[model samples]
Target: MPKKDQGLGPSAETPLPGDDTVVCGVVRHLGGDYLLAKCMDGVDRKVRIPGKLRKRVWINEGDIILVGLWDFSPDKGEVVYKYGRNEINKLIEKGFLSKEFINALSEYL
Candidate 1:
């Protein structure tokens, strides 16, 4: 017998930033449920993992994430999504992430 094809594999969809409010970031530090991330826009924001994703997602430094900026606070935001290693590579290949950005992020890692 062969295994059934479920939609929960490595080929799972990787979400892209929907608009200007959402941007790519690299986790710089972990403080419990909150994270200090450096975004592509060159801002360091204190972002939190909302209750819906707090228990479901395990984020760590060096991981790539999508942050949804708060309307009232420019320095704060919430974690919208997390990307896997493969997804990161895909983003790079797709031209969503530039090589210079990834190289700069390497210093933190």
Candidate 2:
């Protein structure tokens, strides 16, 4: 299979059963390979977009996402949330996010 067409698979990156966990954050940086987001769980976690999953998801910095992961550290958790548009939109429109924040989120989509 072509590298470009290689969709995010089950083998991409899995945060054991206890790394870290949360569901929202601020985009801090868009790295050469992955994204760096400020987790809302009060844990300063630097996220990474797994090799096979980066291009497949519409993940942007500053966008809030529903995360599901294990304990990565005392202040950070590994990411498992990839494509959660509906969830983000609902939270944004429900007054959890500002217009500017939502706009920023769109840039990644």
Best by lDDT: 1
Per-residue lDDT of model 2, residues 8-86, tens digit only? 5444343222233455564665466545554444454566555445556566666565454444344443456553445
Model 2, residue 78: C-alpha shift (Å): 3.6
Per-residue lDDT tens digits for candidate 1, residues 54-74, read 766777777788888888898
Clashes of 2: 12
Per model, how many backbone clashes are there?
Answer: 0, 12
| Candidate 1 Cα outliers beyond 4 Å, as residue runs | 1-11, 30-32
Residue-level error in angstroms, candidate 2, position 92: 7.6
Tell me the TM-score of each prediction against the true structure. 0.78, 0.48
Q: Candidate 1's C-alpha lDDT?
A: 0.77
True-structure RMSD for candidate 1: 4.8
Worst 10 residues of 2 by lDDT: 11-20
